[model samples]
Target chain A: MKFSVMVNEGPYNHQASDSAYHFTKAVLQAGHEVFRVFFYHDGVNNGTRLTTPPQDDRNVVARWSELAVEHKVDLVVCVAAAQRRGIADADEAKRNGKNADNIAEGFRISGLGQLIEAGIVSDRLVEFGD
Target chain B: MPTVKKMMYVNRRAPHGTGYALEGLEVVLIGTAFEQEVCMAFIGDGVYQIMQGQDTRAAGMKNFSPTYKALGDYDVTRLYVEQESLSERGLSVDDLMPLTYEDEDDDWAEKPSVQVIVRKELSQIMAAQDVLFNF
Candidate 1:
C-alpha cells in the first residue's frame, strides 16, 4: 500500500512528530511506498537544521533526514507554514531576504498543493497532530 | 485526467485560539485547485469558526472567518456543521454565517453551502470520503 504522512506538530514538544516518524519507518519496513511526508503548522520545524537536542536524546530532525536518505522518502515542508514559523530553505531564505537558511537535508519547501496531491495519489493519508 | 477524490477537511478546534483553523482553511483553499470533490466538517469547537460576528481587531489577529465565504468561488460548496456540536456549544445554525454558492449546473442559482447534520450523518459522510484531513 502507498501512504502519505502529515506531521502537524513540532518535535519534542509533542509526540506527533515521533509517532509520524515511527509510522513512516514501519510502513517502509513493511514494503509499502511512502508517497510523501508533508509537514504543516509547527511540524515544519522538523525540517530546520538548527534543531539541537540533548546528546543523550533522539534527534527528531536528523531521524527524519536519515529516513529520507535511506528509504528515499519524499519529505516536504509547507512553504507558507514554514515561513510563518521561521523554517526556511536556501531558496526561500534568499527570496525572503533572510541572512541564512535552516532547512535540513532530504526535505524540500513547497506549497500546500503537495499535501493535496498526496491525498489524491496515495492510498492513505495519515496525519499526526495535537 | 487525475482522479477526483472526495477529500474532507475536519476541523475540531476554535478559530484564533490556535493556528489549526486558519492553516486548515489554507489547505482547503489549496485543495480546491486540485479539482477534487472537497468538503469541510466543523465539529466540537470548530463550529465556532463559521459563527457570525467574529471580530479579531481587539485580539490583533487577522480574522480569517470571512475567508470561508470565498470557498464557494473555488467550487468548494460543502460545509458540514454538526448539529449536536452546535447544541453542545450553546449555538444554532442562525449563529453561523450564511455561506452560499451559485450552482453552475443549475443556472447559477444561489444555494446554501453550510449543512447542519446530525453526528450520525456526519460519520457516514466521513466514511464516504477518499481522504480525511483532520485539524
Candidate 2:
C-alpha cells in the first residue's frame, strides 16, 4: 500500500511530529511506498534548519531530515505556511530578497497543491496533529 | 496522472481563532485542480466557517466568507455539516449561508451543496475516505 503523511503541528509543542515520524518509519519498514509527507499549518516549522535541540532531547527536525535522506522520501512543506512562519529554502530566500534561508535538508518548500496531489495519488493519507 | 483517491477535509477548528480553518481551506481550494473526489466536513466548531453574515471588519481581519461562495466554481461543492454540532453550538441550518452549485450534468440545474448529516452517518462517510486532511 502507498501512504502519504501530513504533520500539522510543530516539533515539541505537540507529539504530532513525533507520531508522524514513527508512523512513517513503520510504513517504510512494512515495505509500503511513502508517496509524500506534507508539512502544513504549524507543521512547516519542521522544515527549518536553525533549530538546535539540547543534547538530552531528540532533534525532531533533524530526525525527519535524516529519514528523508535515508529513505529518499519527498518531504514537502507548504510555501505559504512556511513564508508566514519564516521557513524558507535558498531559492525562496533569494526570490523574496531575504539574506538567509532556514529550510532543513531533505525538505522542499512548495505550495498546498503538493499536499492535495499527495492525497489524490496516494492510497492512504494519514494526518497527525491537533 | 495517477488514480484519484476519495479525500476528505475534516475541519474541526473555528475560523480566525486558529490557522487551521483558513489554511485548510486554502489547501482544499488549490486541490480543486486535481480531478478527485473531495468533500469537506464541518464538525465541532468548524461549522462557524459557513455561518452567514460574518463581519470581520471589527476584528481587523480580512473576511474570507466570500471564498466559500466561490467554492462551487472550483467544483468543491460537497460540504457536510454535522447536525449535532450545529445544535450543540446553539445554531441551526438557518444560521449558515445557503451555498449552491450548478449541476452541469443535469442541464445546469442549481442544487444545494451543503448536506446536513447526523453523527452516525458522518462517521460512516469518514470511514469510506481514502485520504483525510485535518488541521
Candidate 3:
C-alpha cells in the first residue's frame, strides 16, 4: 500500500518525529511505497542540518535523510512553516538574506500544496503530532 | 479528470495559543487548488476557531478568523462544528461567525457553511473520508 506521512512536531522535545520515522521505516521494510513525507508546523525542524543531539542518542534529522537516500522517499518541508521556524535551504536562505542555510540532505522546501497533493495520491496519509 | 478524494481537515486546537489552527487553515486553503472533495471539522477546542468577534489586538497576533469567511470563494463550503464540543465549552452555534457560501446551482443563493452535528455523526463522516488531516 502507498502511504504518506506528516510530522507536525519538532524532534526530541516530542516523540512525534520519532514515531513518524519508525512508521516510515516499517512501511518501507514491509516493501510498501512511501508516496511522500510532508513536514509542517514544528515538524519542519526535522529538515535542519544544524540539529546536534547527544552522541549516544539517535539523530532524528539524519535518519530522515538516510531514509530518503536508501528508499528514495520524498521528504518535503513546508516552506511557510520552515521560514517561520528559520529552517531554510540554500536557495531559501539566499532569497531571505539569511547568513546560512540549515536544510539537511534528502529534503526539499515546498509549499503546502505538496501536502495536499500527497493526500490526493497516497492511499493512506498518517499524521504524528501532539 | 483526476480522481476526487474525500479529504477532511480536522481541527482540535484553539486559535491563538499555538500555531496549529493557523497552519491547518493554510493547508485547507491550499488544498482547494487540487480540486478534491474537501471538508473541515471543528472539534473540541477547535470550535473556538470560528467563534465570532475574535479580537487579537491585545494579544499581538494576526486575526485570521475573517479568513474562514472567504472559504466559500475557494469552493470550500462544508464546516462541521461538533455540537457537543460547543456545549462542553459553554458556547452555541450563535457564538460562531456566520460563514456562508453562494450556491451557483441554486440561483446563487447564499447558504450557511457551518453545520452543527453530534460527535457520533461526525465520527461517521470522518470514517468516510479518503484522508483526514488533524491539527
Candidate 4:
C-alpha cells in the first residue's frame, strides 16, 4: 500500500515524531510504500538543521533524515507553519535577510495545498500527535 | 484499482493550551475537501480539544472551538477519543462537547461518530491507514 503521513509534533518535546519514524520503518519493512510525509505545526521543527540532542539520547532528527534519504521519501514541511515557528530554509532566510539558514536537505518547504494534494494522491493519511 | 489514501490525524494536546487542535481540524477539513477519507484519534492532552465550552480568547488568541462544529461541512465526521486518555485524565464523555456535530449554520446537530479506544491498541487504527498526521 502507498502511504502518506502528516507529523505535527517536535522530536525532543514530544514523542509523536519518534513514534512516526518507528511506524514508517515498520511499514517499509512490511513491504509497504511511504508516498509522502507532510509536516505541520511543531512537526516542521524536524526540518531545522540545528536540532542537536544530547549525545547519550536518540538522534531523532538525524534518524528521520537517514530514513528519508534511504527511502527517497517526499518530506514536506508546511511553509506557513515553518515560518510561524521560525524555521527557515536558505531561500526563506535569504529573503528575510537572516544571518543563517536552518532547514536541512531531504525536506521541502511547501504550502497547505501539498497536504490537500497528498489527500488526493495517497491511499491513506495518518496522524501522529501529542 | 487506484490507491485511495485513508488519512488519520492524531491529536495530542487539549484545547486552549495551544493551537494544535484547531490547526489539526484545519488539516482535516482541507483533507476532506479533496475528497479523501479522514479519521481522527485523540490522545493524551489532545482529548481536551473535544471538551465542551472552551474559551481561549482570554489568552488573546482566537476562539476556535466553534471550528470543531464546522468540521462536518468538509465531511469530517469521525472523531475518536482514546479510552486510556480519558481514564488517565479522569474525563467523562459528558465533559466533551456533545457527540453531535453541527452543520455550518449550527441550526442542526449532526451526531458525530465518536469512540473510546484503548491506548495500546491504537496501532490497530494506525496500521490500517495509508497516511497519518500528528498534532
Please list the C-alpha lDDT of all candidates, in the order they appear: 0.95, 0.91, 0.95, 0.79
Candidate 2 per-residue lDDT over residues B13-122, each given as its tens digit: 88988878888889888888887898999999999999999999999987888899888888988999999999999999899999988989999798888999999999
Candidate 1 lDDT over residue span B1-135, tens digit each: 348988899999999889999999999988887898989999999999999999999999999999999999899899999999999989999999999999999999999999999999999999998999999
Q: Which has the higher TM-score value, candidate number 1 or candidate number 4?
A: 1
Name the runs in model 2 displaced over 4 angstroms: none
Candidate 4 chain A lDDT trough over 10 residues, lowest sum: A118-127
Q: Which structure among the candidates has the greatest DockQ?
A: 1
In model 1, which runs have C-alpha deviations exceeding 4 angstroms? none
In angstroms, give how far residue B63 of model 4 lies from its true place. Answer: 1.8
Superposed model 3: Cα runs more than 4 Å off: none
Clashing pairs in 3: none
Error of 1 at A96 (Å): 0.6
**Clash pairs detected, candidate 1:** none
User: How many angstroms is residue A11 displaced in model 2 relative to the true structure, after the best TM-score fit?
Assistant: 0.8
Kindly report which residue stretches of model 4 are placed more than 4 angstroms away from their true locations once superposed.
A29-31, A54-58, A94-99, A123-127, B1-13, B37-54, B69-135
Would you estimate the TM-scores of all the predictions?
A: 0.98, 0.95, 0.98, 0.65
lDDT of 3 at B26: 93
Best of the two (2, 4) by lDDT: 2
Tell me how far the alpha carbon of residue B115 in candidate 1 is from the true structure, in angstroms, after superposition: 0.6
Alpha-carbon lDDT of model 3: 0.95
